[model samples]
Target: MTTVRAGGRLRPPDTRGAHRDAPLPAPPVSRRRGLSSSRVAGWGFLAPVVAYLCAFYLYPLYRNVDLSVRHYTVRSFVQGGAEFTGWDNFRQVLQDPSFGTALRNTMVFTLVSIVFQYAFGLALAVFFHRGFRLAPTLRALFLIPWLLPLIVSASTWSWMLNSESGVVNYALHLVGVGRVDWLTSPSWALTSVIIANIWIGIPFNLVILHSGLQNIPAELYEAAALDGANGRQQFWRITFPLLRPVSAITLLLGLIYTLKVFDLIWITTKGGPGDSSTTLATWSYRLGFGSLLPEFGRGAAVGNLLILIALAFGLVYVRVQRRQTT
Candidate 1:
């Protein structure tokens, strides 16, 4: 019970087990009200990117999937007679005689090109990292191949590798070696294209890896030296670990670029010498565009397969990047 007075009041007795005075709790913060201008600006900036991806990437992907399933032709478009074909195109492409050969060639080309490109690029990067007097000039010179237009580079390489009067043959003659048919021969044509690809790819790898090497702290090398580690030991122990992320990025990009290589191959061999050098991309081109039959459906199927492979590689790259960041 409580007794009340005129100016001062006596409070009622507490029914609780214990009684104590506690400070009032703070009011809850409204998240939206509390957001900083920076956060608002960040979301505002992201809105356009979100809209663009939805409109461009997702819409096109959906359309490509739809197109792959449907039987839409040039005549069908004019006649309004498009229909859906259930996996028939994929079956036809799988059954094609050149499919196996094209797959093999593409795989071989990708593997060989990646190996040589990375190896040569790493070697060049290591050499440049040693601080040569003319390294900057040499680095700029190496980038010339990358800067050249694809058609120009392919044409130049083709002329140089020509068996009869090319510079390659002339050099061989000077070295007391017999002339070899570089582009005309089935065995040599693919190799020649691969060499050209390696040249184009080397600069890209070098740029990436050299930047990575430059980012490594000099103190690490100095410490390793103090611990009696040689150059090879220091590279494997310190340099390799730090360069892993860059190496992964370079490899993924190189593989993707090498997989889709077409212009060089087309200009060099045109998948010629009896389809010996026909890659998946070139094969798809030949089937849908180059052939009399013009199997558009089959070509679409091959393109879809390539897309899947690229997606898988992309997923792998994402996972690796995530792991590295963490």
Candidate 2:
């Protein structure tokens, strides 16, 4: 030994032994600064949709609200000026005699259409869910009406329902039932429109319900069967409960579509035969464009009412959805 530390004696260093110090580790990169490429791509993809809604949906909604408070015309619009009228337009729309009739007719059409469309659609969906021969082909054929242009379908249905020289009358004649004036008679005009609407709506309902039925897991049905539950019991307990969400969505959509129907009634009857078939949409159009002095303000009010009704329905739908999800 040659040296000693503060409190101990030191031995001589051995040549064969070695002492090593580990190198300091590099500093870690900040995780906060490291952006995920996938997350950035998702935001990039969603930007276009966000921009579109702001431009189209929000802008139009703002314009509609602005128009609802003003007295505007084709000339006023061209002149770039309009006078403000607060709630007078709403008052006029409410005071109109035909407005009540339109409201009643729209309500009837919406209710009846919802009932029949859902009933037939649910039935057809259940039938096809069994996977019969040619089921796919039949389902495709059924969707054809939905794929067709609304104007074309309306025109075709109108021609077929004509009192004279139409297929319906010809068939009736063959069966000795005589001719029926489907569009010309006030009594039948609204009913005829409702029937056509129902026909057009059925395909959509069927497709939705069919998809809903298909999504029900087969194991649930098997379990029910194993427990000695019959077909009716299984449907009430399993199928209906599972389908509530889809049914709610379909019903709300159908109600909105039916309430706003104008083209079919216009093409067929033009709300004619003493305005018996005029729904809210047709009446609003008549008030705005069909009159000598167009009532833009009043039409706007009616449109606002329609918007409110739709919004109410949407709120109800959202609430129901939230409850279900929770």
Candidate 3:
């Protein structure tokens, strides 16, 4: 027998169990060194990725910030010199009359696109979630728009929405409606781009919302059914409440993406019909590269503004998400 003492209490241990009761010896020095070496090797494996991010993302971000406050130009880009200008770049960006229009168009385009995309996408998600025959095939086919390159989609829509000879106008003519200028008309150009973006965006919504809907247990529906709840009631009482998190994240992401949309608008309208379709993205490009003077500084300022807006939205999204999870 042996004495064991801990926490101000004492007990007896059997001599036969001495080996099992003994504290294990520390590992050999080489084994301890091996653990530290393995840790170093693990970090070594991540070195390349860290280096890549620093070289690309972090460096570009730093350059963007630097450019935003300086008088950068085509000449400066070629000669590697730019003069420091305090808030003049931001002042010009804010003072530009067209900037106001671009801001409004960006707002309208982002809001309308998200609303329609969410509406149609959620509807399709629910419709397909019921699992009818050929549903998978049809869902796959619906993703064709999303699978197509943005350039391809934008060009196709441009052709389809052409003012005079387009399929959309032709269809409208058959209904006794006169020709509608889609891309060329200032009043309708923003609307046309928004419509195209909405169509392109719906597939994303459907896929995400569909996955969320699938995660909800079928047993809940069955129990609700036994309770004599109708279809509409079950949807609002069961499905809608369960889908809030998915919907919030999807809408926020869509808003951020839509706010930065340039390719679709550029390819279709070129933000044209005299700035009618100009968004912050296209406007920023026009400032930096498309202008005669090439106000790279102003463009950087706008880009930074866009980044700040995205960050604000992201913060709100994070807060909402955390509240939901908690």
Candidate 4:
């Protein structure tokens, strides 16, 4: 405190501290350095993910887009003198007769697979949610289709649906029904592939929907039951509404998976019997690498179409989700 003498009385002591007693401002350089280090550390942590996306996702997408717009023969694809064709490849694909069949087949395959997979999955989830002695065992058994390798499952289905000696035909013979060409005729071919896909996808839905069911409060169901709701009523009122978010995600994922399904179709039917069972996925592979002379541009265009379809569905889901949240 500063003391100054007055004529008659002592001046009041100064309460404020001197400049030397004041705290120093923090060094901005150090603060800036700290922020820089933190930012670097954050980016360091994110670098791997970014790199992975670039290498595995972004680069391939770029290449696919490039391929779709260029006239790339096998040699040109490798040696890099492909002429740009803009949308010519897309036009060619649209003009082809197979495009209509492939488009229709793709839609049918995706929608049918998603519908049956979700329905069967929800049913199984509900059934198991009731609990039983063999619930775990039964659920595990049901996952056999999902857990098996695609090749193995597709091959097994191929054998079971074989026109001549398939067990399906044998079982049908036990009844009054005769052998049906599951994979040969155009009418049955897409259905056969869809059936196989549904089997493969059901367990996934079951697992996800069951988990979602677990999240729904038991009290809700109990309250509904006490209100005289039967099983079906309780499911509709309590379960289905609560399960909508899960169902949306499951359906979206299934749509994406079923859209790009190539291995199973290729392994089972090879898009055979004259493009009868051909979906966009199989058709893309056929155009790109199915034979000696690959139509790289057209094939890439088909793949781009598939990507667009998936993207559209994804955008729709996001919009719906946003609306629900709001």
Candidate 5:
């Protein structure tokens, strides 16, 4: 440290450098105006995306809400006519037999998919979190199912699970377990669809959970080990608790995606073997476009219901996030 001689006595060094090195003052008014202009330009660049969402997502959503409260049919679709029916459409769809089946199927499918996906994903994430030979390659390979397009995956699975001569039933027979119809049967159709969904979703869960696991500090695990904590204990008390945010997002996204799944179910069973596997999305399509005479109002009503459920889940996610921050 430097010293200064003041009045012939040795004195401490000048310490004003800290303050001298402080941040500069705010920019000039003209520069501030430039920043405002930049922000406007940034938003201007986003104008097309904003307009696109409004034109497609928002407008379609608004129409769905409107259609839910109206009487819309083939005539209405063709000739542009709809009469406001208040809650009649909602009531009718809610009371309909197929709607109940769809609701049940949706709940079962969503819950089962989420459970198996998260469980298997978490296991893989934890397993692969540690460094190992070929870890990256194996992890990348696991993502193939998720990367495959829904329609292609569905068709491939359809062939694999064909009741008469599919590879799945063939394997079962080879093992003396007897052939089982993977689809086309009312009892097994939903199960088959759920299985495909679970398989397709596992990669997503694995990636997300693995990333979350990685974000956790290694120091915590070292401390836990020093404390004589076992792997399971450390996971529950340390890993799981710390990974809450990522888990929340993963589950939320899974739920949203699972709730709106259409192509998988459509290509697999078409909500069929007598509507046994019908979820809200499939059921809505069935009403609006699958029938001889489209029940557009009913379809819209179901869609709105599904949307409301999704909004509820979103609200829950927001609350959980807020709590986490607090």
Candidate 6:
């Protein structure tokens, strides 16, 4: 027998286990080192995103604000030492004759586009949620408008709505209605752009609203049906109430998007017919780049107004959401 240490007490070693000695376990890994390495890796992944936002978003916004405050001529824009006029640029923008027209058009275009887009989108989403035959295929087809490039869509509308040889006039002629000058006449130019914008926007609403509908439990509808609720009643009581959050967000997004719609209006009518179709967006572009003499300061001021409008609506949304949650 040989002495062995057991719990700090002397004991004789077992004869059967005397030939084998258990080795001590390896030391545990250092948690502090592992955590520090993981933190470094996380920062490495985040650096690119932070840099991109600073470069593209924050830097441009700062420059725009700077441009708005300073009276910069083409020479001064390229060179340095532009005069800082403070709110004079904004005042000029507000006092200009075209400002009223642009403001009115902006309001009409934004409100009309958002209302029709939401209405049509919500209708389509509800219809498609029924899951009828070929519904999936039809829903995908509706997304074509949203998927196409904005330029292509605008150009297509221009061709279709051409006064001389367009399909729309031809179709109207078949029904004995005279051809209406869509893009040219001041009276109809804004209306024409609004129609095109409405068409382009509906699909976005449909996709978002449909996703919201999917999250609603089907049992609620079944329960309503079992309670002798009619289709309209069920929709009003169950569907609409549940879809309120989605509708709010959809409308907010639509409002923001429609407010800055420049491409379609520009490509189709170039905001033409003597500022009839000109919105704040087109007006800003026209001031900055559309004309021979660019008013960079005034243009930046108008652009800032648009930004402020969007920001106001965004704040309202956040407040409303907070209230709902609380």
lDDT (Cα, 0-100) at 139 in candidate 6: 99
lDDT per residue as tens, model 3, 1-326: 56899778897765668787899999999999999999999999999999999999899988988889898777787787789998888998899998899999999999999999999999999999999899999999999999999999999999999987799999999999999999999989999999999999999999999999999999999999999999899899999999999999999999988889999999999899899999999998988888688878889999988888888998988998898889
Model 6 worst lDDT run, 10 consecutive residues: 18-27
Question: What is the alpha-carbon lDDT for the whole of candidate 6?
Answer: 0.95
* TM-score of every model versus the real structure: 0.84, 0.84, 0.89, 0.89, 0.87, 0.88
Best by lDDT: 6
Question: For every model in order, what is the number of clashing pairs?
Answer: 0, 0, 0, 0, 0, 0
Q: Report the Cα lDDT for candidate 1.
A: 0.87
After superposition on all C-alphas, the RMSD of every candidate to the true structure, in Å, is 5.0, 7.3, 4.7, 4.2, 7.8, 7.7
Tens digit of lDDT per residue, candidate 1, span 79-127?
Answer: 6556889788788888888889999999999999999999999989988
RMSD of 5: 7.8
lDDT of 2 by residue, 240-299 (tens): 999989999899888877778888888989888887998888887887788888877777
CA deviation > 4 Å runs, candidate 1: 1-44, 47-56, 77-80
In model 1, what are the clashing residue pairs, if there are any? none
TM-score of candidate 4 versus the correct structure, residues matched by position: 0.89
**Candidate 4 segments whose C-alpha is farther than 4 A from its true place:** 1-34, 321-326
Residue 319 lDDT in candidate 3: 91
lDDT of 4 by residue, 139-239 (tens): 99999999999999999999999999999999999998988999887778888988999999999999999999999999988888888999989888889
Worst 10 residues of 4 by lDDT: 12-21
Candidate 5 residues lying further than 4 Å off, grouped into runs, are 1-32
lDDT of 4: 0.92
Model 2 has an lDDT value of 0.86
